[model samples]
Target: MSTLSHDERASLADALSRVLARQYGFASGRRQNLAIAPEQLPPIWSTLSELGLHAVMVSPDFGGFGGGADEIQLVQRQFGRSLLVAPWFQVAICAHAVARAGSPTQQGALLPPLSDGRAVMVLADRDAVELDAEPKVTQAHDTARGWRLEGRKTAVLHAGLATHYLVPAVTPNGGTGLFVVDSSAVGIGCHLSRLVDGSWSGDLRFESVDAQPLEGLSLQHHGEVYRSTEALAIAGVTADALGACEAALEMTVQHLRTRKQFGQSLGDYQALRHRVAEMYIELEQVKSACDLAAEAVEGVDSVQPTRGTAQALLVMSQSATWILQQAIQLHGGMGMTDEVAVGHCYRRMLVLNARWGDTREALARLRGDGMTKEMPGVAGS
Candidate 1:
């Protein structure tokens, strides 16, 4: 994974901001229906594709910019801020997994479409989104053609729009094997559902669905690949949460400055001002945690990558949730309604917090990994 230079980062951020501003305002986003059919791609998806945003995760070998976690943060943060609804998050996760683990032939076959936005693939992990929730849903059995997958994966992001699904299944040997299944394959059932944030996901039921291993990959190395990919997924969502928190705080401050109480602006009140400042401090903390998490996923930092991401998920989930809640409270009655942006922001944060691994799950992972010692300023009492 290659890190981008400061100049490249700035250039990419500026371009994304300009495009998102013109194409994805709150009003426009509000017009987007929560239920998107599998065959119907959003118009904005084509625009983003034209901008080559999808290429951020693919390697240069496959006609992409060869970006790592840093680039993903830049793109996803903007997605979070505008509450953009698309399958980019799923693409980032899937692309990173393939780039890190797939063989050359596999990369050649998959990477080009992925980077150019021609394909949408999602990871279907039983415990990927929720941690240790229930009985394992899916298992892969070896077949002459390749494999057969039987079970279900629920609440898969952009599953409706996916061309393929990357499923991790339990092999007979008790190790995880990653497989690719076409969304239109026989015996595959996809039931679309709207998420709280107006995005869509699918409940996938695989009944003897034909599948192939993620091409020439060694199962012995699967554990490391899975861990790193999970770390990246956490880091990616944390970046989105950071963006959402920033937007929520900004919306709150704007409301306070304009909305009046007893003919005095709400921002004029000393108590309210202090609360906004606290929110600002929390936002900064989230920013730091987000950066470190990205670095950890990229293996550019001293912190153990997987453990670092788990820690980040915990910290950001708490701070981001608090920031959004404060935003809603500051807005008074209007905040509770979907008519305003803060409510939407809060809902978005809730979804992000729950995804990947929520605060409680992250904490459990940290404790399980023996990371109980509190860092001096990082993990406060």
Candidate 2:
């Protein structure tokens, strides 16, 4: 259940919508600037901080709202509609992990800066961490001085903008351990690249890099932490993709109503109307799946969160692809151009689908988990 009342949720969503409308529209070069040089977006980030969005998921002990998955869904939905590129994965995943499991010292040092937008911390692991995949390159060694991390993490989300990295490594004991590495540390190397949706990612290399563990967590418990954190991350992006799907459907519908062929608007065509109806059905399913996943993340009372989240992503990946493909097909040749909003929406959805675990892998992960009859969003449920 949501901590905020219905009115408050509406008010928050309206505020976010107004701000993005005023300052963050995808008008030609502005979209290009936001995608290519997000570092130049300090003003927008500052505005979001002042609105207390960064503090939404942070713990109240560190002067935050201590909100749950509902708040994350609300904020991310607005950003997704506008296709705003920010380091939100950092807040949604890394900071949540620290707040949920960090020692008092770690929380005190990290959460305040994060709440005020002074710092951004990203998760550095393999592309498939949602499946509990072991790190292929990074390893951690313990010494009297502390933990030292070696090896590299590739395709790190928002890595170029991060102040720190929450990295998972294979420890000498063969258990997975989480560590915090300062991006400016001496042994670190970062190479940035532009993704298909015009967002930035980094290939990060660490050579004998100094690091700090989230205190009080033994290696035995890190696996649980990793799974929950990654699950929440999936829920976050699913909400974002839901918003994009909504906008894409709306845009395509509008195009169909207006664009005429053979002296008749495209909407007059029976076959095209049928396609729109199918897209709407797919969208409703996506909405259901996304909501179920968010609720699962909030409760986290059982392994349901993991199974439910993977199931939700799979539903979203399949449904959203159909919605966007139909949106593009209905838009005809115009949809293929970057100027069309649906084209951008398609690219963003593609990235979100593949970012964690894609449909095939998520289905495999769900194959053996007994379905919870109570949560219909999960596979086989």
Measured by lDDT, the strongest candidate is 1
lDDT of 1 by residue, 141-258 (tens): 8877768988877668878888999887776665666778888999998888777888877777888999887665676555456666667777788889988888888889899999
Candidate 2 runs further than 4 Å off: 1-3, 28-42, 127-137, 299-301, 368-381
Estimate the TM-score for candidate 1.
Answer: 0.92
lDDT of each: 0.78, 0.77
- What C-alpha lDDT, on a 0 to 100 scale, does residue 237 get in candidate 1? 88
**Candidate 2 local lDDT, 41-140, one digit each (tens):** 3457888988888888887788777777778888888888888888865666787889766888899999999888899988887622224544344778
Where does candidate 2 clash, by residue pair? none
